[model samples]
Target: MRIARTVGMVMAGGMAMALAACASVVGSTESEVQIRTNPDNAHCDLSGYEGFAASVETPAAISIPNVAAPVTVTCRAPGFRPTSYTLNASADGWIWGNSALFLASGGGVAILGALVDESRAAGKSYAEEVHYQLSPDRPRPVRARSRDGGTDLNLQAR
Candidate 1:
């Protein structure tokens, strides 16, 4: 009878461990990132995931899903040259905790949990904050002395 009770307790413990997904439980499938520009209020567009697109003004916060891919951010403002940035995902540190879970739950349950996290991309994240700097579209004009002693206007793009 005591042996049977011990077996039941062990089975219950295993079941509980199987349900503990390190990344899903401790981390998130999405994270919020702050976007800022040298001059505020630039129109920014974010894309990468299919059917997922967002637009916002600079100096804002955006919540993006965690994926094993890159997200592109493009910004534009009047009189300023447009700029684009690629946001890459890095592995979340919490995902590594699954290795520790192996010791507690044995290899099988821990591996299962890790696979679930991998499928859901629960262990990837983008940078917490991103900043962009845009240059002016118009260039300054320079005055040069011509051969006839007349002033000439030289338009240069710098």
Candidate 2:
């Protein structure tokens, strides 16, 4: 009888451990990122995102993946010179995935997280609000000054 009870308890413990591994302590596969621009309404593109979530508009919010590489954000607005920025993903401590086995949620969640949410403190991905200020491009129809003390409009197109 004693032996049978011990075996049952051990089986229960094992089941609990397996469940813990499914949980992650940090960032998930799908994360939220906010995009903002100084003037607003700028076109934004996430160059490194693997799926359809590659692009959005300024003042936009979108979901991103934790396991994917850092993404380059490109922004462009009319009359403003296009600017490029980057969003980085670092490894999260929870990536160890072994902690989950101990019910710490920081362990053993690596592979599970990778398969499900990709949770890892340093390995996990998080989003930061990306903002940019676009500078105005030079306008055409520039004027020229001559040494003879005369100003001429070069609109004739040399």
Candidate closest to the true structure, highest TM-score: 1
The per-model lDDT (C-alpha) reads: 0.82, 0.63
- The C-alpha local distance difference test score for the whole of candidate 2 amounts to 0.63
Model 2 misplacement above 4 A: 1-5, 8-16, 19-27, 49-53, 96-123, 139-158
* Model 2, span 1-158: residue lDDT tens: 99999999898667655554343533355567787887899988776645534777779988776545677778888878888876787655555554444454344533454454343323465555667787776666756777788877475321
Backbone atom clashes (below 3 Å) for every candidate:
0, 21
**TM-score of every prediction relative to native:** 0.76, 0.59
- Scored against the true structure, residue 152 in model 2 reaches a CA lDDT of 72
Per-residue lDDT over 44-103 for candidate 1, one digit per residue giving the tens place of the 0 to 100 score: 998976456889998999988886257888999998988898888788898887787777
